[model samples]
Target: MKLLSRIDIRQLRILSSLLQERNLSRVADQLGVTQQAVSDQLKKLRETLDDRLFIRTSNGVIPTPYAESLQPKVEHILAALEDLLTPQTFDPRTVTRTLTLCSTDLEQIVILPKLLKILRREAPGVRLAVKKLELDQLSTSLLTGEVDLVISNPDFAPPSYPSLSLYPEHYACVASKANKTVRKQMTVEQIAQIPQVVVSPSRGDFSGAANSWFEQQGHPRNVVLSVPTFSAAKACIAESDICGFIPARLLPDARLRVIELDADVPGFEVIAVWHNRSSQDPLHQWLREQLLAVATTP
Candidate 1:
């Protein structure tokens, strides 16, 4: 059977590291190997690949076209291998580590406040980094450990990672008090006839199940404005006659009134996701528990 040996893997890894650091000595130090060992590996790599992968210069080694071409594939393979070998176990009480989370702005505004408070009291040393992640990259981001957890609407397909439903949030049609067109309640037909604002993170089009509900009810709303965030939609609603659908939990402010939809629109299920390998991790488990607790609170 044809096989790339483990030594080949090690050599590729070393080559990739050297390309990144641009200094053989630094790469050698990181790898805990002598500079001669790195040079010997580089020589074997050049023989195996039959190309001058790197050109030595006065400053440092510069990658040849061949080396540049191999960088991405090598990095991906190395990342995948590293992910495979990463320890899944974690101890929250003993471990002082940062957990990276990917979530939407609405979720960050609504959920993270309480979660941060709890974390500060419970795990004082642990840190958190929250990044806005677009829906298209959610699955791969979780799989690759780009983010430890993703809090997203469960309507989107559950990522390859292990996921659990946090809570259900219903859609509400919101309008400013000054807008005389919509009152406390809006029928499906009435809502469809009004100028609407749509919120979508990816396409900036109608969001969640709103489009599906409109189509199912045989009435499509005319979307006058499209924005990338729920807050933008709410702002549009507050500024004009345009009404938009948003999560029910986002109703703390008095600038807009959330009206119930006459048509049966499906509620959004919020989910917390983590890599399958991290399902048993104590830190991940604690984070999930804290998030779930915050979600459950009235």
Candidate 2:
């Protein structure tokens, strides 16, 4: 260890160049130092290594067996050190790592398709693994590097982590086209009286955000069923005479018709959240930018 401690990068480079050029004057000019400077460094190298690495010749110098044996190892060491000193850069085009995302089915349905299209085109090699949002395990997963990003509305976003707002989401009252109870246009009172399905992805209760909005206006919605995801709720509402609040982005499907409401519906902001450790990560930042663009896109 002390033998290596006495040797430094400057001497190593001088040795590397001297081995290649086999001449003191050439090594001096190549390293932008004088022949005497090269001689002084070579002297130090010889003392540290306990071997006269080269033999002075009338023409220049010839490498000894010990110096010849070190040529490959010295080159390897310099290359490794040079690589270690360089800063890492992110290039989406060449990325091949899998990015694990945690989000509810609503985001997986409404937001992920648009994001995937961009990813497939720009970062062809970057794979994606989507995990359903589990509130109880979210903080541990995020902090332990198991989850890369979380996409959710304010109600579901983890309270302890910082988040970036992607966009605002409004809900529309929708009913199956076959449903006969809905009128041409209904008051919130009339709509609240009909059978309703509320989406509560992380909870099993037949309650949801729409209940609060309905209760605020003094017309609590009649909840007949609960589903775990927006996609599941959409499926149930399309086949049954049930009405539920659906995000505006998932509207215009032929299976269901938007029910005109006499009252204004409430909306929430969607956001991307991450642990503080990833606040400056290039991949996370890029993903957030893509999500923002996708959510804001027409």
- TM-score leader: 1
lDDT of 2 by residue, 97-161 (tens): 78899888878877899999999999998889999887677776775567988888777767988
Give all candidates' CA lDDT scores. Answer: 0.79, 0.85
After superposition, candidate 1 runs with Cα above 4 Å error: 1-91, 157-159, 206-208
Which residue segments of model 2 deviate by more than 4 Å? Answer: 1-88
- Listed in order, each prediction's TM-score against the native is 0.74, 0.69
* TM-score of model 1 (CA atoms): 0.74
**What tens digits encode model 1's per-residue C-alpha lDDT throughout 57-149?**
888799899988887677667766766775776555566888899887778988999999988888888899999757787776665466889
